[model samples]
Target: MSRKLPLLIAIVVILTGSVYYYFTFRRGSARTIQTFAYLRDPASRPELRMNAYTQCGTAPFIFPTDGLVGFIWDDSFRPGHRHQGIDIFAGTDVGVTPVIAAYPGYLTRQPDWKSTIIMRVPDDPLQAGRQIWVYYTHMADAQGNSFISQQFPAGTSEIYVEAGTFLGYQGNYSGDPNNPVGVHLHVSVLKDNGFGKFTNELEIENTYDPSPYFGLPLNARENTDTIPVCN
Candidate 1:
């Protein structure tokens, strides 16, 4: 049949160029742009500042137990709804301690994201994926086997965390402390309301309220939000 019609038109032109290279080059090369002059966000759009980053707040602190950051939607699953991030109470064990990189860049992974640490800032070309995530939900079992050291049975890795190093330890993995009472450390920061805003898969409702990027300055017993004058 004419050589099977040129092998079915070369397998439909290589499956239509792999679905047009997965939406124009793998989801636009997993978009990344915020490249540290200090992870910018001066209220976002100033023509989207292609440089001079400065959301500067977290760059440091990652404690796993100093408590008092609150924001828990898992108040046994949603008693009052709020939890977008920040928990640190680490008590029930698994305290191998050392999860940093509050401000650096390039390290991504997302498998329903139960274990995460993303910080991308490819030199502020308008801070592309403008990321910042650190979620280790009650990670017992030797801090989830010391965060993907290798042996990927579907564990996801590329664990390069350094800007404060030590990315593992502190467990409870977000539940079951005799019906949930203690063991914390949930720290988080990931604001996404730009770049084609999202719909659902809940990035904390497209986050953007990380207590003013954790620069700390609200004391009515904390959590009044918006306090990042990062200078």
Candidate 2:
């Protein structure tokens, strides 16, 4: 009887160990399978294009025709904050320089390029309420005429701009040229999702800081051959 008891105990221990091993292995395998499934899902793909092109023009140190001085935060504009966009120096000397689209997308023209260009990226999935938009201002004619373009004021219906397509010219319309500074292309980006998109609409509306997106400085000087002719 004593010998039989040891045998029976050994059998029970073995069975218990086997059961533990089975459950442990099963759980680990299940986790691995779930991870692989998540990786295979198409919706989890990355959105940013590393080598994508910008929607602005390619000219020899010339101003973008989209005439813009800088951007002002909506909060800054309301009361005593007093803020504005970063103005890229587009000297009055080079008036009406052709502005081109930085990237290929649908163009939403503002009353003036002075402050907005919403670009819905071609194949990017909707990021909730984050839509990319660019803004430019401080536009004027060679004769120094500065006024918000008469075409569209609040917003326009639709305008197609291919990469490098002409938009408009640069000028010093934001304020007097000499009082504080000269004309410049104030470039900025705003993201919108449309739902409660009204709040926090402009994400990174900084001054002409398109370096990360376009791989160039705000005032990049391209080769003469690439520069467009003044028309």
Candidate 3:
């Protein structure tokens, strides 16, 4: 027991701290790397961002979260840079807000960042049979080890999950504990090119309009509802 004191302390720290990383918006340079950035509408608020994050444009999909909240799809973050994904503000803090698998498929974390989760849904209608990779980032509660990886581990870096399986929580922890973003979920999807390869999500052609994917209007700048999902 004495020799294992260090291990015990680490476990307690993870359990108590909730293990959130917020390296930066890039999910850390080494741990990058995906989308979900938008300019906030002055008329509305952050809730709109959350709404865009969860809802798709039309049928065949619904808002991933309980309901629409702060902000959503806004491509004005940088000049000529269109936001490829929707930003969802789901949690009041770090560990409490859980994000589920949008569609059942294989689960894997980003290259260097365990906080950034990538899910491969192999049966996307948009893709003939190439598969779609749902990229989930900004997990404020993710440490070096991922919730999905910790729960399901194998030799390969691939872990399969159900359509609505519990992926992890929605957080703003990027890749370092020192940096924290606005505390939201950056969700995006990409075309899978087989062999576990995926197209670049930042490239507009490489990304999908999550609005149609989630069955909601992400471009709602008219301000109808606004609440701090990140509250």
The lDDT per prediction is 0.39, 0.40, 0.54
Q: Model 2, range 1-231, lDDT digits (tens) per residue?
A: 997999999999999888855543332233234323333451341221111122324321222333222222221222223232233333234344444555555666545344344544433222333445555544553333543344434476456556655555555454444453344444544444444221233343332334334333322122111111122
Query: What are the per-residue Cα lDDT tens digits for candidate 1 across 22-42?
Result: 433222111112211112333
Largest TM-score belongs to which candidate? Answer: 3
Each model's TM-score?
Answer: 0.24, 0.42, 0.61
Tell me the lDDT of model 1 at 120: 42
Any idea what lDDT model 2 has?
A: 0.40
Query: Mind giving the per-residue lDDT tens digits that candidate 3 earns over 20-57?
Result: 22211222222111112222332333333343224343
Candidates by lDDT, descending order? 3, 2, 1
Please identify model 1 stretches exceeding 4 Å from their true place: 1-79, 84-133, 136-154, 164-214, 218-227
